[model samples]
Target: MCELLGMSANVPTDICFSFTGLMQRGGRTGPHRDGWGIAFYEGKGVREFRDPDPSCDSEIARLVQNYPIKSRIVISHIRQANAGRVCLENTHPFMRELWGRYWTFAHNGQLPGIRSKTLEHYVPVGTTDSEHAFCWLLDQIRERFPKPPKRQTTLWRFIHQCCEQLRELGVYNMLLSDSRSLICYCSTKLYWVTRRAPFTTAKLKDADVTIDFRQETSLQDIVSVIATEPLTHDEEWQRIKTGELQVFKRGQPC
Candidate 1:
């Protein structure tokens, strides 16, 4: 299994604090150290980085830690290979172009026999069940609506339906984004927290570090973070129920 991290903010924000806590789990606090990757959605563009090595020791991961690239939506994953070989090709948060926008996906569970499922348009370059499922999901969406739908609810419900079908196969906890909205689905576990005005200092669960968000944020800034588990030791996190599909926009669940 892997671990997932995501962010949706009303204003552009860097995920440095949360990311640092997660990076420690890549090898130190957790066992998902096979590979790691992250994607940041900046308007219509995406900044992504991937490495087929333990994030705890990877130089690329270090660079990501040091850089404060701000984005409205972000998704990240650290893997402990179950369905694919440990290599660059199998590393996630995978990205693809859809409806003229870059879409990012990352999964934290295994889907046995997922490759047997048929795909029409999108084909995976990697041999992981996670990637196969992602391609299949996008293909289904493309088939359902040749162009973007008139209503966002239509697309959002369709995504939930697709995720439900995937959940029938196996554990399907995931984070997905189309550079506009962040979609999260839970088969087993996922937690989230929202921080806005009157923010307080939060301590990391995996690292001995703390951040006073009040000093770094404006009164209007609303930020949300989602992870496989609670990232901060002091703050309360809301867990997504099993079989739940949550859509987040501008730091609030919709």
Candidate 2:
């Protein structure tokens, strides 16, 4: 299986710290080394970075670690390549324009028989099952609402149903975002941790890295991080139950 990492914050924030821990695992500390990608949502615009090379040694990955690129929503992935060949197009955190906003998606598990399902409005440019599944999901969403829903609850329900239906297909753990919100679904493994007022130190488990949140943040900052595994050894990360979907908008959502 691959790995996922995402962030939703009340205020503009950078994911460099957490991303550093994940990069080391792309080929050094763990096995997910096939490819990697990340997307940052800055208002209505999106900044995406992808490379088929292992993130452990990618120069681009090194730059991202040093860059304090800030955004309200973000999604990232490190792939193990169970269902796709290693290529630039096969990388996760795929992007597509929908309802006038760029929606980004990243998947963490394999799906069998996904190739048999042909899609109409949305089609995959990459051979990866993850991209196919993302296109299929967008098609379902478009069918549910010709345009973006006017009500928040209606849209939430629609997104949940689409995820539920996809869950029936195979392992479908995913992270989706459109700058305003981050929708996460867990079919097998996922975990999350939130940092808020009275922030404390978090020590990375895969590297000798630690960040004292208090030193770099204000009381108004609230950042919620979701990942395939806990990034820190001391922080209590909440594990998402299988078949669960949660939306994080402005750092909080049920």
Candidate 3:
């Protein structure tokens, strides 16, 4: 199975610190290294990078780990390749245009017996089942609301119903966003931890380094980090129960 990582911040926040730990799982400290990709939402522009190479050794991954690319909504994944060829087109964190905005999606679990019957507007460029599922999900959303639903609860409910439909097909742990907030649906393994006032140090389980966010952040900072597995050894991460959906904005789950 692949691994997932996501960050939701009330303000534009850098993912460098948490990304360094996730990069270690992409063929270094963990086993998911077939391919990798990440997305950083910067207003109307979405800066995304994908690599077919193992992130543990890829120069691009190294650069991502070194640079502080900030975003309000971020979705990232480290692939383990259950379907599709090992190529850039098959990487996770795929993007599609929807409701005049670029919607991003990434999946962590394998969906069995997934095949494309037909697509109306969007099509899958890659052969991965994950991409196929993403396309179908986007299509469903567009079908339900040709225009964006203004109410948060309405949009959230729409996604909740759709997630249940997908889960019936197979495993559906995922992170989805549209530059505002993140919609996290956990079918299996997923955990979340938020850092805020009275912050403490966190040591990466894979890396030997630790970071004290208090030294680098302000009093109002509240950033939520979500992953397939807990990244740090110290923080008490809240694990999402199966079939539950979480909405994150400005780094806290609501």
Candidate 4:
């Protein structure tokens, strides 16, 4: 199994606070320590960092923790390596180009026999079933709609349907995003919380730290965080039901 983290914000925001909690789970607070990766979407481009080492000990991970790379949408994962070898290419938060836009994907569940599904437009660079499923998903989307759909919901619904089909294979909790939208699907566990005006302090469940978001954010800021588990114990996190799909854009659900 693995852990997933995502963010969608109305304004460009850094994920240092949330990421600190998640990185602890990579080896200290949790058991997923095989590898980790993160993708930050800046406008149409993505700034990505990955390492085939425990995030708790990786120097690269520390750099990311210290650097405030702001983004409107982000996807990150810490892997335990159930299906693939512990290598750089086998890391989660895989990326690919589709419809002339870069899409990022991260999974927290196993999808056995996912490779048996044929892919047309996309191919996996890694051997993990997660990556194979991502390619297959993109393949299916490309087949159904050669170009981006006119109505955004049309594509979102199709993605949810595809996720349902994949869920038949095994647990399929996932986080996916283009630069504009963050798509989350829950199979067993997923939770989300949005912070807006009159923000309050939030303390990490994994670390001895607290952040008063009010001091760091403006009244107009709206930020949503999605994770396999709640990062902070203080905030009232909303759990996503099994077999349900949620889509977030500009920090709000759509």
Q: What's the C-alpha lDDT at position 68 in model 3?
A: 85
The global C-alpha lDDT for each of the candidates, from Candidate 1 onward, is 0.94, 0.89, 0.88, 0.95
| Model 1 regions more than 4 Å off | none
Specify the poorest-scoring 10-residue window by lDDT in model 4.
114-123
- On the 0 to 100 scale, the lDDT of residue 187 in model 1 is 98
Instruction: Point to the candidate with the largest lDDT.
Output: 4
Q: Candidates 3 and 4: which is better by lDDT? A: 4
TM-score, model 3 to reference: 0.97
Candidate 4: tens digits of C-alpha lDDT, residues 95-155:
9999999999999888887877998878788899999999999998889999999999999
Q: Compose the digit string of candidate 1's lDDT tens values, residues 49-163.
A: 9999999999999989889989999999999998889999999999889899999999989899797889999999999999999999999999999999999889989999999
Clashing pairs in 4: none
Model 3: per-residue lDDT, tens digit, 1-254? 89999999877889988889998999989888899999999986799988988999999998989888878888899998888989999998999999888989999777776663356778999998888888888888898899999897798899988888778878999899977789999999999998899888999998998999888688898999999999999899999999999999878888
Q: Please count the clashing residue pairs in each candidate, in the order shown.
A: 0, 0, 4, 0
Encode model 2's per-residue lDDT on 1-254: one tens digit a residue.
Answer: 88899999888899989999999889999998898999999899998898999999899999888999998898999988888789999998999888998989999877888877779798888898889988988888888888988886688777878777778778999999866789999999999998898899999988899999999899999899999999997799998888788889887655
